[model samples]
Target chain A: MHPAGSLIIFTVLSGLGFGLLAFLGAGVVLPLGWEAFVWFAAGYALAGGGLLASVFHLGHPERALLAFTQWRTSWLSREAVLAVAALGMMAPYAAGSVFFAQPLPVFGAIAAVLCLATVIATSMIYATIRAVPRWHHWTTPAVFLAAALAGGALLAGQLRLAGGLFAVLAVALALHWQAGDRRWRDAESTPGSATGLGRIGRVRLFERPHTGANYITREMVHVVGRRHSAKLRLIALVGGAVLPAMLLALMPASLLAAGAALGLHLVGILAARWLFFAEAEHVVGLYYGRAAA
Target chain B: MTDLPETTDKKLGLVIDLDICVGCHACVTSCKEWNSQGYGAPLADADAYGPAPEGAFLNRVHSFEVTSEDGPPQLVHFPRSCLHCEDAPCVTVCPTGASHKRAEDGIVLVEESMCIGCGLCAWACPYGAREMDPAEQVMKKCTLCVDRIYNENLPPEDREPSCVRACPTGARHFGDLGDASSAVSQLVAARDGFDLMPEQGTKPVNKYLPPRERDRATAAPALEPVGEAGGFLGWLDRALSRL
Candidate 1:
């Protein structure tokens, strides 16, 4: 709820990384009967590498295996289970595709579904918490889906033969930008409403109980300036969406150009994720006198 | 291990009289003294008798002056700590079963050694009762002086918590709420006692009795002064009063 940059980056980055891997694995493993397995392998391996990098960000990565135990109640646990399942399906698919000269359709389809579900689960984990007003909205799921779609498109582009999927990526990027805009506006409106006071009323911080910054302030009341936020939004929209769309349309269907576009998109996604955290206000922000407008 | 039940047919809880509480913070000091020495880890204070002292105190009395349309300035002294809820969210959220509520007497407690400092229990509570001991990296909260209460060495009458004993105005009361005929239960039934943040759905067991209303019949109207000049005694009396 405090919108920690580390956590936001972890979520968005990992979503892209894992989503791409899953998509690549699905393409190669599933019986699309694609000409070359090398491209699929390369994309899947790259995405998997990103996924591995993201795990280091967790506070208790050692306890992640225990995450599966609470699947009955916690979506986090379900996500962990599905993540392992997807990876497991991919392992055999990768082996069969490269070495055995055959791809497993059933396993690939299951892995693809599981990967999508995992992303949804990850999104819901943050969105479900009632304490965070900005995240506890319908737009959260859409953001998650868009991130995955964009990541999948990047991976598809890396494979280049499946360049047509870039259209899907372009659409997803547009949707993400629109959703981000709406969420920013909604947050601005709602933050002002958090104090349970009207626009005309003036509230001042005459006294505070604690002299030193407490956990509440450190964890909940992170504020970002309007100018920087707007700039970041612009960067994300252009770099993540518009440019990628152009590259997908105009460029020779070469893996090198597609890779560049994907890299640029990832950079844009980083900016977007940063803004998502920096702009989104927590309900607890009211206590610190940071209610919206 | 079969041990004797701490309270035989008793579910002891607190009944706080809002009218009598002056918010002196004596109860908080007594609780810290009793609990830290007997049951749990010390309520460690940093920089005591120096520049800044920061520590965990088991009980805290907050002073707030509320002004209502129908009444004069109402000073509400809210003493908050752990409510020891019936549906304790802390226990349910504990991943390692470190926190639990007793089925015998309904006392919620934590096994400090077992706590991994995950901070989930703290999030579950709305009262801000649970605080993490930074030194040990474990969650700590009020134990209701469990060690002092059940000790056989102390007399039967001294078995109650230190906060209840140290209350100057007799604002604090502790007894079995489970027994219908008990004094605390009877007092709760007689007066309209309410729980703090009932909408939180924690179902806290501790009850606060509302401040009693005063009768208007005992009040007298002030007389209007006749002139600006007054006698020497009256003038001296007014000056002394101001001084």
Candidate 2:
């Protein structure tokens, strides 16, 4: 879990983009004239940008097309396929809703469902990493889904919807943080369990396998100190959720408040996502003397 | 293709004896030499001749001291590589059909030509078994010497993994693990060999033999003075002087 910049951007941006599309597709927001096109265009842009950013970190970016073909098993593949389907369906729905001013009820409904599924699939890509106990819990997906919905509501300029989702999102974030912090405190895997030497006794590393960091060490052994984690957690809470919620409450009084809330929320999520990657303890880290087991 | 087989015909794997491994890296070097020139992409190194050198290696040996309160501390050398699990998550997580487990032999391998090198397979592997080669933009790992083990051109005696063939102490053993009557299987049963991470439940084919304990009575202890007869000039002191 290197906390790669590209991947962070991909996850957060795609989540918001897809979330916005879900709202629009379901006819929750009925924008007139050019506003409808703007909403759809912005959603597509963010979603597509996140996807392109994801490819940036791949060793073989040219072969990404083949990724869609493995949806039968790979969650990453399923996400890609669903994202494309969501975008495809959104195209016609947007045309009908924006150009003809007649929302295709059936198409909109299907597109909305696809958008939500795409976001869930994307969340599952990280949530299913069993080696990282913090991310493996059901809380991971709960936080991700809530973040998408809340972010989507805010960006779509639906104050009441955003207000409601902000409360739900707050609860999800608190739960995710509590569970993740507990996991960090009570790491069940030790070098003994990781190496299967627990039957002998408590296994502690006497020597590391290498002098310098190797691929496993660099990729998986992310050690965020307790104090630093506390600070970041505070920032994620105040900025990602609290500040946005407060700003949205005042949005009806001032148009500038919406933009401020959206901006603060995005930055807050960046910090949160960074913590997400930084805090995950991959089991391989046990071999490096970086994780419990 | 991503799904594992319900049953494989023969489980080909290795059994590493922790007792005999001397921390010598002969297996690691031999693996690098053989695999760099054969069957797959070369195990490339970055800044190999520079101040800080980093590279990809298939087999690695680690030495650690395991201490017990009642006895003297023991230094154990652990040789690590792929275990070729029966239900390898590495194979299941590959987005392309590149990573697969052989239904015939239960050996997991990556088809480099089809690999997208997204590194998901590496993340899925709990053993830290997968290696990504930056040169080919592909994932490389211990193939169990897939090329030589089945090569008809090679001599029958040479038909083994490079690590097993090059082990100086013969600590690494290879055989058909699927057969209950196989020599390796019998060795495992006799030695009480165990899987590295049974809790992960990947059902690794490879097993490790725990080190045998030294008998306290047979172990050498510091020589005590032979009473008032000869405090500094004891038989043990004389014997040491002779050496």
Best by TM-score: 2
**Error in Å for residue A184 of model 1:** 14
Residues forming the 10-long window of minimal summed lDDT in candidate 2 chain A? A195-204
TM-score of chain A of each: 0.78, 0.94
> How much does each candidate deviate at the interface, measured as C-alpha RMSD after superposition?
7.9, 1.6
- Which model scores highest in lDDT? 2
lDDT of each: 0.62, 0.83
C-alpha RMSD between model 2 and the true structure: 4.5
Docking quality of model 2: it rates as: medium
**Candidate 2 at A165: error in angstroms?**
1.5
lDDT of 2 by residue, A17-122 (tens): 9999999988888775589989998999998889988886788888888888778888988998999999999888899878888878788889999999998998
lDDT of 2 by residue, B26-139 (tens): 999999899899977888877778887777788777776666666656777888899999978888777888888999999898888888888888888888888788578788
TM values, all candidates: 0.68, 0.93
